[model samples]
Each structure stands twice: as C-alpha cells, then as structure tokens.
Target: MSEKSVSTVVIDAPLAEVQAALFEIGSYPEWLSSIKKADVIERDGENRVLKAKLAIDAGMMKDRVTLDYDWSAAPAALSFTMDEADLLTQMDGTYLLKAIDADTTQVTYELTVAVSLPVPSMMITKAQKQTIDAALKELAERVA
Candidate 1:
C-alpha cells in the first residue's frame, strides 16, 4: 500500500443520480479530463463492468491501465484495483456516496497508487489532489 489521498465534495444531485453517473464507466473519458479512453473488457451477469482498460494522461504521469471493479449496492460504493498497468505498480480507489438531501449528495474519494517511476511522495500527493478535484467537479457537472 502507498500513501493515500482522500477528499470529499458535494454534488448537486441525488444519490441515485450520482451513482448512475459513476457506474457509466464507458463515458468516463467524456467527463474525466485525465481519462483519454475507457473500454470495458468484461461484464458480470447484471451487465456491470467486471474489468476495464483505461488510458490516462495526468500531466506528470501517464499510463494505460486495466482494473478490476467491484460495486457494493448496500453502501452505494464503487471500488477498483489495478489488474495490470504499464506505469502503475498499484492502484486502488473507492467512491462512496452519501445523500445530504433529496437533491444533494456528498462524495468521498480515496486513492492509493504507486507508479513504476521513482517520484517523491509530495509530488504524488499533489497529482492525486488535482486528479480528485477535477474528477469530482466533472462528476458534479455531468449529473447536474
């Protein structure tokens, strides 16, 4: 495990709406600035993504990554772990949603990732914050 970056944001949408947007894995590139492409490799019986390949360009770091995804219906959460990647040694993250009102939801994102290159912890944390902040803002806009 590497040092983790955790952050939260409030989305101007209901919990269900926010979760729906998050589950639309194939549309990630449209809203997530870092994601260049997202392709589903496999799906479960419920047609939910089981595996996906993503190409990401995050300024200082870039990689084509494959990840295994798990969705927890009870908690309205989505989590993923890296199955393989060109530059990333480990990638694990989760998105947890909590409703603040009928039309507002709080989203918490936590990520821990390690790249193959030697980079300082401060740099990694800085990148993580930028990624998280951009992702949450886009997510909010997508569901708005």
Candidate 2:
C-alpha cells in the first residue's frame, strides 16, 4: 500500500485540551465542512469506535465508514484506522501534538488514504490534503 500523509495546524491550547477537543467528533459539523455526521459508536479502554459520514465534492460523493481509534495521552497522539471505508482500500491517520513552548504547540496530521473508486483521480491526494487542512483549521479554531 502506498503512503499518503499531511501535517495539522499548531493549536494554541495545551496538548490535553487539544486531545479532548478532538474527542468531541460529534461537534465536527459545527466547524468542519465535509463532516456531515459523526457518532461515537463505542469505547473500549483507550480506544473509541466511531461511525462517520462525510459529504465530499459538492454532494457528488458521500461515505459512511467505521473507524477505530487509539489515543496515547502521554505522547499526545491520536491514531485512526479504517474498519470499512468506501472509496478507500485502506486508510490511517494520526495527529501528533508536541509542546513547542509555553503557549504554543506543533501539531502534525498524517494520513494514508487509498482510493480504488472507479477512476483513480490524480486529485485524490489533493482532496485528502484539503480534508486534513480543514480538520486542522477546525481544531485550531475550536481548541484555541
């Protein structure tokens, strides 16, 4: 599988705050454009199960998929793996928050999303990058 990746925006909030804000996936539609609905399905230990539906490309494409998440609070890392994703053969994303200074942080978002959907548009990477960008922006705005 080929690797796809992106880096997130650095939020002004502390790592714990940022992590906590991200856990509120249900509020994504308040700030995120592509997210239509995000519902937490279950929680097991430090992992979470989610069912997410996203609208993409002006409602031309939509996907509802299950995801499993693993959070490492000590290192401030949130990792997601696809359970069954449409328009994706395999998908994985991670958010890494590292303390840069007292009131600043370094946030990195990375994803590897594979598309076997009909025609493999050369723009898949661009689209995924835009998604991550919007996510980072929302995170910054919410947690900042």
Candidate 3:
C-alpha cells in the first residue's frame, strides 16, 4: 500500500522481443544483477510463470521472496505481488510495455516495497528507484 516508484526506459527492441525477455523469468538472474537466483514454482497452461521464488541481494536489501505473477495482460503488461518474504512485508511490481516503432519499445516499471525492518521513507524510495533503473538497463542489454 506504499507509494510506488516508477521508471520508464525505451529499449531498442521490438515489443515481442521485450515481452519474451520479460516472460523468461527463470533467466532473470543471468541479466538482473540484484537477482542472484530465480526458480519457477508454478506455470500456467501456456507455460507462463505463475509463481516464482527469487533470491535478491541488492546492497542494503537482501531477501528471498516468493511472488505470484498475473499475466492476463500479456504482451503489454506483467505484474507480480510477493506471496512471502523474509524481510519484505510488501513487494508489488508491474511492467508496462508499449510499442513505439517496429524496432523500439517503451517499458515502464512500477514498484512498491515495504520492509519489516525500520527504514527511512526517503532511503526506501531511493533504493527502489535505483533497483528499477538497474533492472531496466539490464533488461535492455539482455534484449539487445
């Protein structure tokens, strides 16, 4: 329920390519630095990841979180909510993609996080922005 931190980046890739990269959740640790490991817990009928367990270690923030993904919006958007975590009380995120051109896509990432430990609001917000920026950059690199 906390305010979400949002960031948008334009990637030099087609919408389908970007969506493909995003959908391969298990491969995230290979590109996303903060994510040390990603294990798919469940998959939908289409083989899309419906639940995943992720091990994250981003400097001051480190936790193993299990998340439930909502893929009803597919190709255009993907959203996830944390089902369980050691340190994180609430972790919810969404990725919105828009085709800018035949070879370009605009990606917007929105995240809201609340920790069990006491942390300043400003620090948490800053960390969230940094995480989003890094994720976007890595995603772009992976797709390109």
lDDT of 1 by residue, 85-106 (tens): 9988988989989999999999
- Per-residue lDDT of 1-97 in model 2, one digit per residue for the tens? 5357586577787777776677666666776777776777776564553444343331323566567776545357778788876666766888888
- CA shift at 89, candidate 3, in angstroms? 0.2
Q: So what's the TM-score on candidate 3?
A: 0.97
lDDT of 3 by residue, 11-118 (tens): 999999999999899999989999999999999889999999999987767999999999988778999999999999999999999999999999999999889998
Ranking, TM-score, top scorer first = 3, 1, 2
On TM-score, the candidate that comes out on top is 3
Q: What is the C-alpha lDDT of each candidate?
A: 0.88, 0.68, 0.94
Q: lDDT score of model 1? A: 0.88
How close to the true structure is residue 108 of candidate 2, measured as C-alpha lDDT? 88
TM-score attained by model 2 = 0.79
